[model samples]
Target: MNKYLWRRIKYFILCIAGLLLALLIWGVIEPYYLDREAVVAEIPLLSPSWQGKKIAVVSDFQIGMWMANTRTVAQSIDRIVAERPAAALIAGDFVYKPGDNLTPELDRVIQLVRPLVVAQIPTYAVLGNHDYGAKAVTEASASDIQRADRIQQALEASGIQVLKNEAIVLPNADRTAENDRLYLVGIGAYLPKQSQPQQAIAQVPSSAARFVLMHNPGSFAELPPGTAPIAVAGHTHGGQIRIPFLPEWSWMSFVEERSSWSWISQIRGDIVRVSGWIPGYGNADNRLYINRGIGFSNLPIRFNCRPELTVFTLQAKT
Candidate 1:
């Protein structure tokens, strides 16, 4: 080969090598890096006394997955404790494929989340599809119910309140007056039709500031207008591998469709909505925020998407 052609060949080889190295770091190293995102939310009807209080949100531990990011989960919880948020919210999917034996996974999950209890930070959670072992079961079976209950019991034992279609008024450090209270409503997983937004919201007094916690973003649609001033969710994992400018190529699409992958879904942008605020969702009064959780599913690698711990500062709406 001539000198110019040889130079061209060398350049081509170097470009290919560089691309592989980038992909390797993105897919392997990125997943292990946890991101702490701070956001400010202005909630309607929020009490002045509760203004500027921070709430930490994390989700989808998926403990049993091969090469799961359990270390990240533990570290994230520790950070939440250190931040000393008024409360920490776990959006769910505590284990991945615990199968018939859930004891080991449950123990691992409890151990990872125990730090929050030790730190005395109030924590709340809701179960996801994986926790119920009903990823594919639209109608929950007896086994599924048992699995969900076991997971819930373990979390509760570890000092995390597992709310299923329940609402509680968060006690304010200042006062217990009606105007000072903020309601937190947590509903069940949307998969298997377990989420009951109406029933959960019923417990919240009207004209009070309320926030909802759920495992699936789909549940936000079930909420009536003005019921959820703000809501938080997980289970998308930010598409697990978000291709820049090509969100439609997310791997979550395949998992959601589950054997019915289609060009139409891609063209219509039906891929799972990922982290941060979801635009044009729910009524004008309802807002939803999805957290990018610190775990893996379908595969253990993540590219262009890092695990997240969200710290939200609540501001009283003007």
Candidate 2:
């Protein structure tokens, strides 16, 4: 071959090699790199005392997935403790699917989250479909409900409060407060037809300060207006293997099979919100923040989307 032709062939070969290396890093190495994201959310209904306090959000710790990111989960929990947030909210999917032998998997999950309880950070959680032993919303069954209860028991025993269609009024940062408490309304898993947003907030007064937590972002629509000044959720896992700016081409786009469940279609676009805040995502009066949780779904790989631990600093709107 001529010198010019040889150089052109070499250039083509180099380009292919570069592309392979990039894919390797994206799929293999990126899954382990935890991104500690700091976000600021303004809750107009928030009490002055609640302002400036930080709340850490994380989810989708599919602990039993093939080659799960357990190290990343532990590190992320440690980071939350170090930040000393007012509270830590775990969105759900504490386990992928532990099958009939659930004890060892549950034990690992407890070990990972024990620090938040030990540090007295007032951690709270809600269950996702995976935690209920169902891979899809339509797959939920009575057996799955029993499985979910076992997981809830493990989490509560670890001192991490798990809410299922329940609401808790958080005490102010200082112990002296008697009123103006911030309400934390946690909706249950969308599976097994367990999530009940209306009932979760029925006890919360109309003018009270509050936020909503659930595993599926689709549940945001069920919440009444003004009830969720801010809502947090995890389930998409930021599409697990996003294609960066071209999020429409994320892995979820290709992998999501057609389903009768309305929410299944929206997940392809949810990857766009990846690791930060989205204002007025559901109801114009409400805001939603989606966290790119720390684990895998069906595949143990992450591309541009790194595991995330979101630290949200609360500010009262004027």
Which runs in model 1 stand beyond 4 Å of their true positions? 1-14, 246-249, 258-273
lDDT of 1: 0.84
The per-model lDDT (C-alpha) reads 0.84, 0.81
Residue-pair clashes, model 1: 0
Give the C-alpha miss distance for residue 166 in model 1, angstroms.
1.2
Q: Looking at model 1, which ten-residue stretch has the lowest summed lDDT?
A: 259-268
TM-score of 1: 0.91
Query: How well does each candidate superpose onto the true structure, as a TM-score?
Result: 0.91, 0.90
lDDT of the structure predicted as candidate 2:
0.81
For model 2, residues 175-255, the per-residue Cα lDDT tens digits are 455456888899988754778888998978777777788987778778777678788888878777776577545675456
lDDT of 1 by residue, 1-318 (tens): 899999999999999999989897779878778999999988988888888999999999999999999879988988998899988999989998857888899888988988899998889999998887766538788888888899988888888999999999876687658788888999998776688888999998887888899988777877888788789999788888878877546777667645222212222235435678876667658888989899998889888788999999999887
lDDT of model 1 at residue 147? Answer: 86
